[model samples]
Target: MWLEIGRQHLSLWRNIEIVMVNAMIPWGNHLLLPLGTLREPFSALKRADVVIVHHADMASKLEIQAIESMVHKYNESVPIFFSILAPSHFIRVGNISYTCPLKDISHAILLCVSAIGSADSFVQRIHKMGPMHVDRLDFSDHHSFQPKDIDIIRKRLHKLESDFSAVPMMVVTEKDYFRRPEVLEHLGYEVLVLCSSLQILPLKGCNEESFKKCLRQHLEIYNLA
Candidate 1:
């Protein structure tokens, strides 16, 4: 249905279509939706004028090559690009606008909590920040925190404090923080939101400028620019 809509938009309205693949688990199990993660077959790449692999920073060179090989199988000439979520700064749970330095959590015990799709990436990024210790609690993507969940987190925080002889800080992705800041703010532990922004990675002759140029070329080809 989505593919048909894209075709209609392209053929009828001359819209340029761009497709994104998750570098973490592209074509999960290589099965379509209801059985696995793919919404369409690998052949769907043929429809994409531009293909972007997200979370490239988390993927290894071999993994990226595998993804690129798969994409090229169906759309051999399509321009492929890579992107990553680059951590920018931190913000307190209640004070969303106030930015904090990434080093604030350095050498501090951290309980990384998140309900985002890429929890591993989130935790990995935190580990790179030189924290004294890193622990994590992952829930399904977009899971809303409830009172029971709060109790669980509080218990974990207590345990970490007991073991480390210091009050461990709670760290979460911006998505989780904004999902229910009120609930998080009342957790009674210092909670910080890890803020990140999408950045194009320089790979395979593609960088930010080259990615923009590719978009412009596609728009010109479709006469949509």
Candidate 2:
């Protein structure tokens, strides 16, 4: 009875046996989904038990509020909530946890990035890693990458992996890498990726406890659980 609401293939919906819905399902070079339309129809919101909103940092406050409003409007009976995202809670780097920072992150090289969750937010979370210097290759949520595409990416990485290159490694979000298991193809370059979770400190109402509230909100909606 769980449904993962997204624009396309997301890990949360990957192994789900039931039918899944998406806003925009990518098909090769084309998008096959209608934006904002749900497969269950608007009336199905009545069965919803919760409404979770996210992307507070990357999106404007108005945007987040708008999402909340949309969810509430669709399922007024459902309890609206928030949940923290990966990289906001902590990052697992090669089986190790590392505290992420907003500044002074230009230390790691070659960021192999992918996410069935939030690619933008994850990339932004590691912005301190570099300014336009990071190898930012994002895949669609649960993207069944084609051999051609993977080859292209490998070639691109090979071409980009050099001493003068920005970062000579691959960084990926743990979500995608864990699911497909084919994302570990950084043979000729240093590999770097987000491991597990990260702690986030919001700029507004900045406090440990209040931040915890926001974190909870993000997790409730964003997490597959």
Candidate 3:
């Protein structure tokens, strides 16, 4: 279905196909459909004129090389770029307009709560903030928080507070907070929403400027812009 849609777009003569890949699990089990995480076969990468790898910060150099090799296997000349979700700031849960500094959690105990695609990446990033200790409550991607889940989170937080004998705060990704702001606000505890934006990583001659230049070149090639 997606290939058909891409073909339809390309048939218009002004469209260029770009594919985004998650660096954490590029090709889950290398299987397709219900058996694995991929929607299409790896060979489908041949259709992509440009490919951007997300969460590049979390992946190691070897992993990126493997991904590049795999992409080149299908399309040797496809332009590959790397990007990371750079955490910008934090917003208080109840008051969305109130922004908090990333250092606010420094030397503080935090319970990282998230239901995102890359929970490990989110937690690891938090660890880098110099938190006294970080505990996590990760749910499956897009899993909505239920009453029982709330109870579980509360219990975990309570345990952390008791163990550390300090006030433990809750932190969640922007995706989780936006999914159900009211749910987090009602937790009756300090909950912060970590916000991040996509940033181009400087790797193998790829940076913000080069990424834009490449895009412009592609646009000129396809006459899209």
Write the residue-wise lDDT of candidate 2 on 109-189 in tens digits: 545557463466666666744645565777776775566656766776766656445645566665665664454553445
Superposition error at 26 for model 1 (Å): 2.3
lDDT by residue (5-113, candidate 3, tens digit) is 3533545653567777888888878776678766677778888878888888888899989989988999999999898889999999889899999999999999999
The predicted structure with the larger TM-score, 2 or 3, is 3
In model 3, which regions exceed 4 Å deviation?
Answer: 1-14
**What is the Cα-based TM-score of model 2?**
0.58
TM-score of 3: 0.89
The backbone clash count of each candidate, in order, is 0, 32, 0
Q: Please give the lDDT score for candidate 3.
A: 0.84
- Looking at model 3, residue 103 earns an lDDT score of 97
Clashing residue pairs, backbone N/CA/C < 3 A, model 1: none
RMSD of each: 3.2, 8.3, 3.2
How big is the positional error of residue 159 in model 3, measured in Å on the Cα after superposition?
1.1
> In model 1, what is the error at residue 209, expressed in angstroms?
0.9
